[model samples]
Target chain A: MPTLRRDFESRDDLIAHYREQFPEAAAVSDWVSDTRGGRDAAEALLDNVDPVEYGRTRNHLSGAVTRLSPYLRHGVLGLAETRDAALAKVDDPSRAYKLVNELAWRDYYRRVLAEIGDAVWDDREPYKTGLDAEDYADDMPDDVTNAETGNDFVDGSVRELYETGYLHNQQRMKLAAYVVHWRRVRWQAGAAWFLSHLLDGDVASNNLSWQWVASTFSHQPYIFNQENLRQWMGGRFTGDSVGGGSPFRGEYDEIKARIFPRA
Target chain B: MNENARDKAVIWVHDEMLSLSWLGYVRRAAERTEIVGAVFVFDDTWVADERLSLKRLVFMAECLEQMPGVEVRRGDVVQEVSAFAEAHGTTRIVSLASTSPRLRRQGEQLGVDWVCEPPFVELPARIDLKRFSRYWGKAKSRVFRTTEEIMEQA
Candidate 1:
């Protein structure tokens, strides 16, 4: 079949054209329709670097995180170029160490993919949790995808991901944990779901990070409690603002007992 | 680099690497080989994959708009690239080296000239690839050096 070629007057036009041209991809939302491309935008993002603040508050939802992954993933900006950009902005390159380390993690995952190849799609090691790899569900639950997980924090993150094609790093970790540990879904399923929606998604980074959360690549499976969400997110999703009491509201021990009753 | 022969070469710019780094190769290649034109092929297999979202396609389209004379075609990679090169009467095809298995396989199938760009950080050929810390330690000196130092050395 011939590839469709046409000019988009605006981003909405491009999105409309894509939806009409490829109806099969309709299940995946075009929420991130305004993503700018090209070298200039990438450079502008790089130029506005705050490596010092990024180190201190990158974990928070309102952190000084550099939203440069989509550009980096697409190779509009190379890792070396981003590193040099960071170094140029700072008086000392060490100030940019946290940011550089994050970038290196991306490179590390790529190298891992290069070495392991198709194995990345499989469990790198057996699950560390009590659960068996085969025991986990191969598909993500529709409730989770529909942002009706009943947990405000998780649902909010899912909504953000669908709307913006981006999520805070900490939010991703929590969501991945919720999928693997709480919902008893396989990390591969979650990874695939994420890859379909994420603008910055790559097979290597996304899958490996999911594997890490699933404890197939890490020492322990990551799990979170209600207090952790409240502390970081405050009343943004949980509390009186949403009127839906936090599903995650519980003590750590209670959460552990509830999610891992067998243990 | 045969100056006269280069005038007839074809440059294939993949969507994965759209930065000036790839452009540098195109410009340098154009200097030595015949610059038939640059081509970006949107592989049908990828388009058909549900995982390939509209955002990525739009992003690629925007990138392509910046490059002059970059023909955007849709078809099987090998056939489209080969037909384009053949149409231009040039067997020579140039592309940036990529770590993606798919891209590497495509390169082999196309029998194109691959150009290796300098990595962000260079690691030893046989280093343990299991962990980032190990790889980062070996590459620290090279990666952490100031741009001015690199430029001065160059």
Candidate 2:
């Protein structure tokens, strides 16, 4: 029942105060996210949201995602109010349709979590991949955890998560795919790793989305090839050969065939 | 109706409802009653168990700073809420509703009252939740309605 100090001269002071208070966490990762929290910050980001451009480029890493997840996750911005903000921005309601639809995904996931409770950590259904859950390894590979994976995209994405405590949705999905499929690790291990790092990490969205990629909560598994990776990387990373050959380099048919050999 | 009754309540501001609007909702639900305390507890055990990074705590702290009425504490939620209420001589505890099982458990332990936030969208009572598309089928029209239109329907 200890009270936290309410006084701080600046953000540095605030970080310093928390570091002293939570030394174990500071020891784990001293990195602090630039994404500030609170209503002022949330409203500022909300004011700049361009729903039209968001629809066009949101799939790409450089897209205008509104970066409102941390706020939304913490409930600093009401979901309904945010949707209304988007609607108010455009004359025709359809222009804001994509953003609104995406927000609904959040609501949908939360409803599932509410119903299932602790089962959010459980596999919602059997793996759609021909492989059994037993086929996946229980431990996260050291290479992936250490961000020492030879794959440029994989390593870059992991490092981005550690350094920023945030990832573009593309980065998140790509890295999740690599962990669950490429390394053949169970999705739970990968989800736990993300929970430790992501600013917006929550049981509902994080675990279910991982299950979506692992094919345990969706119709099929998610996989991407070199071209798809490069397109979304937005030039921040290379899809070029790593160590003289790229693992992601191939057509979806070839990739799927390799990834799901038993299928 | 009396001032003594008005001062007998506390608000448990859990992690999910850190917004100003949530606070406003709690206040309105109190019906002009003077809430003696607004408390947010940092579940250190849960954080350590999850191995959450320091950045997450910092982000939460930042959020708390923006919340004008919340008293920040580090400990078990139930104990902190109880200690806070005892200190302020409050017997009634209230909070905005959340889907988090942990929060719900703690809320029940503290005998907290829940006020539901305004809905993001209204759906049929038995809508399919197995897939996003299925839920969207039932949620889209209601979500797409303008606020004015939604209010008018209400």
Candidate 3:
């Protein structure tokens, strides 16, 4: 019933303000764990740190892109203002360039929706239309709905989305790919559910991103197996080795049948 | 048809969930012109959502009951308004611009005069540091990888 505040000054101040404003929101901002060593430990490992040179780390990259999507979607934040702020903080053009590229991707998807006008749904190259809607019904499929996908990585990401209206950029893309390319569900179906649930869900970004993953609009389609899914979605859920147990163990034939059944 | 008639019948056509400010439009319009009929359009898809709570419907029903000479129509807002206009012989159609583009376009296409009302709740636009921080944090955190962890650590 309550709405999130619609304005903010700088990044650091906003984080602190959100923590102070909402008690439950404390966990919302925590991307990586202070404790490390375990796969679940969210320690963002920096490949190298050079303020002068600017470095890339897996943690930094995923964390940065995912965090802003929610705010920008809600109209609480503007892309231009954020970009200007970054430029003000650091003089390094390379660092600013990398960050700006991420923002451009967000804008790119918006422009795609504005220009294409929902033609993305009409294409239906790989996915069987109306199949996912039938399988998932009003919600997601039982395997996903029942949380018995046996894939810890899949389950963990789903849990993260349910708990916080957030997911890392890489994880979200992988999830969409798994659903569309591997699971063979319609991208819009998945996108619709995301829009209803995700607090930060933006129509342009969510719909186009799902299309991009489904390979409906994209030139290249991608299928994420257990290994790729495991790596991106923190680690597996069962505390066993990555891809251990039946977590990511559904047969391809079975998946194909369930997702893209014999026409 | 005299342009300046003392007793003019005005009809308000709009979507569901009437805001407080929207209600104000009804009050003011009613004062100026005789509010003969008010039609609230229940679009097909919105009805299907099933997620729209009972409270909202009750609130709308209550609002409709309060207005004088207000006629509440259930499906296809534009159609309802057009039919009501013809039946009641409404001289000039009065509508709030908060309605959807489809409805707005349909209204325009039907050759009805429209009046766009500005936002009712004009909260002062003071530079809110707290608000700025929240959105700013969200924006920075997107690419500010350490932004979350660094803040969490702090």
- Candidate number with the higher TM-score (1 or 3): 1
Clashing residue pairs in all predictions, respectively, total 6, 0, 14
Docking class for model 1 is medium
TM of chain B, each: 0.84, 0.89, 0.51
Q: Give per-residue CA lDDT, model 1, range A1-263, as digits (tens).
A: 45455565776776677667655555556654466777888778888879999998887778898989888887888777788888877898788888988988888888888788778889998887777877899899999999886666777888888777788888899899988888889999999888877778878889999998998888878887766765666457552215655546578778777776665
All candidates' lDDT scores?
0.76, 0.86, 0.47
Q: Which stretches of candidate 3 lie over 4 Å from their true place?
A: A1-55, A58-66, A124-139, A234-263, B1-154
Alpha carbon RMSD to native, model 1: 3.0
* Accuracy of chain B in candidate 3 (TM-score): 0.51
Q: lDDT score, residue B36, model 2?
A: 81
TM-score for chain A, candidates 1 onward in order: 0.92, 0.97, 0.63
Worst 10 residues of 2 chain A by lDDT: A238-247
Which pairs of residues clash in candidate 2, taking residues 3 or more apart in a chain or in different chains? Answer: none
Candidate 1 vs candidate 2: the lDDT winner is 2
Best-performing candidate as measured by TM-score: 2
